[model samples]
Target: MDQLTPVVPDDNKQAYAVTEVTPEDAGDVQVDVHTHLRDGVQRKMEQRHIQMIALAGTLGTGLFLSSGKTIAHGGPAGSVLSYILTGSIAYCMLTCVGEMAVYAPISGGYIHYIERWLHPAIGFAVGWQVCIQYCLFLPSEIIAANILISFWDQAFPKARQAGYMLILMAFAALINYFGVRWFGESEFVFALIKIALVVGLIIGGIVLDLGGGPNHDRIGFRYWKDPGAFAPYHEDSGFGYFLGFFTNLLQAAGSFAGIESIAFTAAEVKNPRVALSKAIRRLFWRIAIFYVVLVFVVGLLVPYNDPNLLQSTGTAASSPFVIAFNRAGVKVLPSIINAAILTSAFSAGSSLMYSVSRMLYGLALRGFAPRFVAKTTKQGLPVVALSIVACFFGLSFMSLGDGASTVLNWLSNLNALLVLYSPSVGFKLTHVSIGYITWMMIGVTYLRFKKGIEAQGIDRTAWRYYNRFQPWPAYWVIFWSSIVLIFSGWEVFTKGHWSAQDFVIDYITIPIFLVLAGGFWIVKRPRWLKAHELDMFGNIPKDEDVECDEPAPKTWFGKVINFLFT
Candidate 1:
């Protein structure tokens, strides 16, 4: 580590260089990685867009559409409680990520820092896992959009429906092809529409629940009482009720997937430290308001036993939100909500493709993926990575053979396994129930915080963004996360419930990551990284490019919009 070399032509470029990690990876240069793409392309995501992306990415088919399935499995009370608990765990991980993101604000985000603090092999495994999940998710979401479109017109030709998916996928690539700005702006508009839709739905649900619609018959909590707060699946009441709760726990995780996106993509966001701190600070309330509150309201309106919920009709007919509106005789709301669902689902596909492409590029730069994958356009988009991910749209063809419904289930399960590898996901909540992630985050948080103090001398007083409760929250998160993870797959072991597919799907990632990472470590033979030796700032750019050039909104209406959206 002599004097740091410049990564870009302009000295004003961030002080990002090929950092040195453990002495063994590449001797003088740490883990071998391309320094930075300082091609004069600025970080384009505005502070406002940051707020909406976090909200919009998570509010997808899971919340507006699939919540009926969760309610069917876990009942209303159980589902609501599960989201609260799982959301708490996700918050802990997000905050842990936030503390480091503010300090370094790099592209690889948590995984990159995890490699520096934990092991390089672990970092590599996690990064590639993220790429795989996004790769899988990108196509699944496209297929989902196609399915949702069927709700409006069942007679629409399947081939043409698929053609629409391709066109939409290409459009998404173009957004990322341009840069983060396009991705940010597109999601901003998408997220705003969704926010308005959610707000409208909540108000309407409350009105309908109170019998304010044309029917004018106060239903109150009539559905919850008759159906009770719990629903037993095929099993006995005691165990069935409990298993359903576990099922809903995973559901909540799926809904809030990408909780770590803001932290991971901190590199591309302008004013990373301040923007991320605000986003993370507001994250919990967003989950509670958009998800928890919505869940509570939805439960009060729709019963767990609704035939529409249990049928899996693959259309707006099955959505609890739409079901409630239909029951209330609301003429046009269902159609509107269905349309919003389409846009949101499409937006999710695009955003995930964008995220995975960047993750792939980051992996390539770190010497994990092929060097060509890291190749980018002059504007800084990972064009090669984008092309590879976009090619996954070919997977949509699987729907033709097995049917879209069957292929979607397969992709969802695969996405779950990869969730253990990649923290950024919104597919299945049960994935979070696996618990290993919780313990891993706790270990990383504690080790990083301890090492940061002894090594970098970081303290909350000076560091604007730091995880709260210090070493304590990490311990609690580990405790709860472990319990959830162990029992997450426990139902599969039930006497009559054993299913080999369930066991493998739930626990598969544990061995895959361990063996790959362990094997890589053994071969690399990096110096034994001691706890105290962790470099909290090893990868941090020496001089951050501080360009808060976007002018703030000054008008009264603009300020109001900022308060509502941001």
Candidate 2:
């Protein structure tokens, strides 16, 4: 058997050895050895694989099921604004993450970055928060899947739900167990189906607007015009409306929670430099086109005050997509939409499990978790960590018996602030880099020149992809994140009833980061920091050292896609 060669310079090399074996020989090895081998090499996920994972992460019950709630809370105009605003924030954060992932794609993703740049305690806390969020997603998805199934037949619905949940989970486990490529391929196909459905819906919506459907009244923005163009949910003058807007903003931000999944997959991606860059570039438009544009079209087609919009309560049947289909008088569309929702939920749940398990594995590697959980399978699957995550998901099922609305609200509240916090803090810290800091300043300058850019009719691909309009999106992130952080505590000061939730969210990020940093400093204080091991914002390497040596595409089709996308 050939030993794996170290990729770094001899002076920087650590005392680790790798032994490779054939697949037949692999089975005969002890489980511990298998685990070690799996954990040894960093699995490089390909471009399509990253795209598939990103698609699965982004298209969830949130778009279908939760968009209505955002509409109801913010009204039609405010809802659209909220999504656009939050989407901008997410876009900026992803760009920052892209730059880092391109530079050094690691399996641990941000958790590893946090550990290397900040401290182990901060990393552990972030890891815990991420894991909790992902695990909670499981039951939420399961309940959603169950509700979708019941739409077909109520007979033995609960049993069907349980069965489907287990089956989907097992399938995810099997895919992951084989290796990264299998998971990527499966996700790719599933994601393509979703993208097609969405595109078809958008086109159908346009046709319906043109009065092509039965009983259609040339629905050319009648909902918007009749509803007074832009319904701002708050009539209160002064800061009151702003306060309401901020609350709605948090909810909107939460809807885009999983956008960071692109960052999570950085480590596993095959060519971090090209693949990560393309993924980040695509992310901006995808959110703008799929989420922002879709929401705009839906709002214009369906009134915000529709009874169904307010009835969501986190179930698939409550989804605006179904409501829109039903409104369009499209018979049988609801069932198709429901089935799509089921697949979307399963994909999201699988993604959650993968993210949480890898986070646990990262934590364990850093000694923050029990060492045993760090063990991996010969195929490079973190079996023990994955099992723990699965168990946590099973435990989340207890929340099912709790009132669905309450459970959903609690989960929503818990996740809303934390979701934006990680990326916000991560970006701000990453901006400590000279080039990134320069971009941040340039982004701010560009925002001031927004009017000029708009006047020039610059294509979105140019403005958003190139960040040409100055802080095209980063400024919004800084502005809104600051508002949420501050005003989350305002009710306590003004109305007297303290919001523990607000405090937990607003104050949690810094302490969590500090504790992690402090712990790492106390324990394994390295004699010197390795350049490759530094966090996003740490000391910038010389241009030569910073260059990435990504592998070439294995096939012609891959090379073409890579060329087009990159």
Candidate 3:
């Protein structure tokens, strides 16, 4: 009867009214039946689970084997300082990611955040970047494991390396196949074992330095003094040394690649809002105390100039743990530590497989990848995704042949860029303050909130959450990110004459991702640009009410103040 009323059919059938929807209302519409709505997905991971997963993912071959390379590049002083610097960057980025994860706790982690805050193109770019990084990492860890196992040269022949690698891969696959809980539990036990070993090593190193063992030299600062406070690799001027420090910084950062696993597990964690924050805070301190302090201690205990340190590079025997044990006159301990190194490598490789598969699954869910990858097993395992990832493990076998050296070098180069670039984009996309891409989303969010408040005639007092520090984080993020971006490009151009291979390695991946992202944008511009599908935060239907809506003003001044605040 009225303009708003729907007309009934002749047979008295009910008729549905077609309502006019605003663009804002359009985005709020849900399509995926399984998409998380209120509270957004169930949180099942506990604090211990998160910690152990992070520990398992992070405490890997990097500590045991890679420190030698870092020391070799930057000298002990430079290496230690570089690690500290990288740790600081990691801390900042983790904090930024923590803020977002605490709020949304999406299964896709930063990728989803990237999509929400930035463009779908950016998210697609980073998703692939992470996927590729983790895939590359799988092979690197496997190769490291193989090398570590070779410590018992006679017991474990080089010929059996491939076979053993396969077995290990199969074992890791089985563990991961069972589901997240089983994977978390396995990582928990492995992480505990790794942590215990590290503590023992630290205590043993301390005791050895105190003259408790046979080599009774009271190591103290002797190594530090002999190495002249730091290992100076560059023969050039002060700037050369400074540049070398950054080289080590990049390497150290690469070593800590998996540290962000804490954020990735946020979606599955129990009480992620609280647990993720705590884990992030703890991760900062843990990395500082364990990695930075331990590396400092190692550098002091074992002189950077030691022949053993030089020889350990690119070999299982190159691990500082073995060298430290040998220096301390612990003949059997080196063997024990070598075994631990192998286990750590296996753990790292296993974790890589798990992470990459999940990332692929996330990509598929977002339509950046094929839909088949989104399909999961009854246990929620993305079986197709896992299989696709498992195929990359075969790349590890390349290390078994004579081309191993070339493969290692290329992998290293590719890995270095992969590690640096993803975080650069991630920091860029997250609207975090650490990188050049500032929180454009904050401005967008604020404007949207203001409009919603105006539309709903809500008062400012009703606002629940507010950010005191605005634009500063965004400013720093943009400033620093720009610096790093420029630095990366400059480094390539200046050093291009040194090695064309290095130039290609450093610069190629970033552009490839950019092009891919651009292509995706061009193809899906319509859907991607849709306000409702913009991937802002979690796509919560009530975001306007929660984030933007305000209470009614009590007076004109109150309304004016609310307008000013908006």
Candidate 4:
């Protein structure tokens, strides 16, 4: 038997080597994929980078720029409940993904898992949908970054905005074009800045509410009471408040959209099992502190009826935190927050571009795309895939046109597809008053994964990371995500609130996915695998995991640093 030619660089050859087996010798799909593709990629992302990259993707403009919209629509209590409800669902869904990602840590993330575990047609629909989602979403983030820069001067002309957009796109392209290491390090720094800003803003919000700010005015739920805990949506009755809460619920989903980037990069992390496990475990706290707490504080500080809440300035000026600070007679914080959000927007765009490129690469590996797209540079950068996906950045120029809002609406409408169709995917859908069919697909995929594992009799103890609550998390996600996906467009159904364009945009993706998936199913006529016969172990690259080991922290300080950073 020919010894497998190790794919690592010369310096790393002694540290990493595969067993004696050629690609042809491996009959299993996983081994063949491993022999051919897995080792071509470099594992440069550290544990800290994995944690923060997930943060970078999730903590973007939705929280900083449009969270105020949630408050304005739902009022303080309604908005808070919306975020809490959505955040819980997101947490559960990530745990399901964590289990699969930690086990295999494959390149394509959940899309690959869905293909192998569910039907390939389902995977095709999902993978292409996500690619479409990010292609549109990447420019939207760049457009958002341009808007963030406008915080300094809302009067900046379209030409100037176009210039800023160009600069932002170039920076994002630079970050991703090099490799995952650059992507990881950049996101780490951006995530830290975002974390600091959100923490400071949360603390600042507390101070402003307690009369500790320059105004010395005690806020203490005054806004909630005056706004009466719930704002009417499209009417001034009981049904109106329900609509308000539901609308905000859908919006909150958008804020949590890109959290699943962790899964996509799992294959590129230094130590997949340990690093991904740490990131997944800490995700709950990150979401609660960064998102739930921040929104709650914003609600306490700003009333739902604040006219500025609807400003849509696309800058810090419209941010609830910024609004609260200004009302408290503090002026300096807005600029600082705006700068941080600008970085956040850029980081999100860069990260989304990187993720979709990897998704396209995975698609190529599955024969869904051209084989040439699967080729990577020596450093394992998917150059062709990156270039293809990066082209969509041109769409950001649309935001500089006379019909900027209309352009954004079109891009956003297409982006409503999910990370697994995360909250961001749901965000685009809800933005147009549409249901989240793609988001529901995530839950269905996870259930299929769970069913396959059980049917195959896989041992739980041997897994790198096993989520504490088994099947329940899958069930939890499916139930609530299904409810939201189905009823997400309920407001449009109200008697006085009908629009054909809105209705079509709301549910259009449903059929697009159905046609793609169904057509693939009909043409290929792929045989369904019994749960016991599923290829759960085939695609897992055990040799890839063996090539690297992260040393444990020895000293107390090292341990503390490891705990905090990891």
The TM-score between candidate 3 and the true structure equals 0.76
- Per-prediction TM-score: 0.89, 0.74, 0.76, 0.89
The candidate, 1 or 3, that scores higher on TM-score is 1
The clash count for each model shown is 7, 14, 18, 8
TM-score, cand. 1:
0.89
RMSD of 3: 10.9
**How many backbone collisions does model 4 have?**
8
Candidate 4 lDDT over residue span 481-527, tens digit each: 76775676676677778888666656666677778899989988888
In candidate 4, list every pair of residues with a backbone clash.
30-538, 30-539, 253-423, 254-423, 257-424, 418-421, 418-422, 419-422
Model 2, range 1-566, lDDT digits (tens) per residue? 43332334332122334666443333222212212322332444667778655544567666776667666656667678877876777677666545445544555665655544444444555666667657666666655555556667657344555676577667766766666677777787778777876787788777777787666758887777676445444444345445445555656554566666576676555555556666776776788878887777677667767877767433446767667767778676777777877777777767767777877876676566788887765556778888887775564344346643455455545554443221110001110111121223323323322333344453434322244444435566556555555454444444455677555654554454456456666775644333333222222122233235666689998788556544
Candidate 4: misplaced stretches above 4 Å?
Answer: 1-39, 153-159, 413-439, 551-563
Q: Let me know the TM-score candidate 2 reaches against the reference structure.
A: 0.74
Q: Which of candidates 1 and 3 reaches a greater lDDT?
A: 1
Q: What is the lDDT of candidate 4?
A: 0.74
| lDDT sort, best first | 4, 1, 3, 2
* Cα RMSD of predicted structure 1: 4.1
Which 10 consecutive residues of model 2 have the lowest summed lDDT? Answer: 424-433
> Relative to the true structure, how large is the alpha-carbon lDDT of every model?
0.69, 0.57, 0.59, 0.74
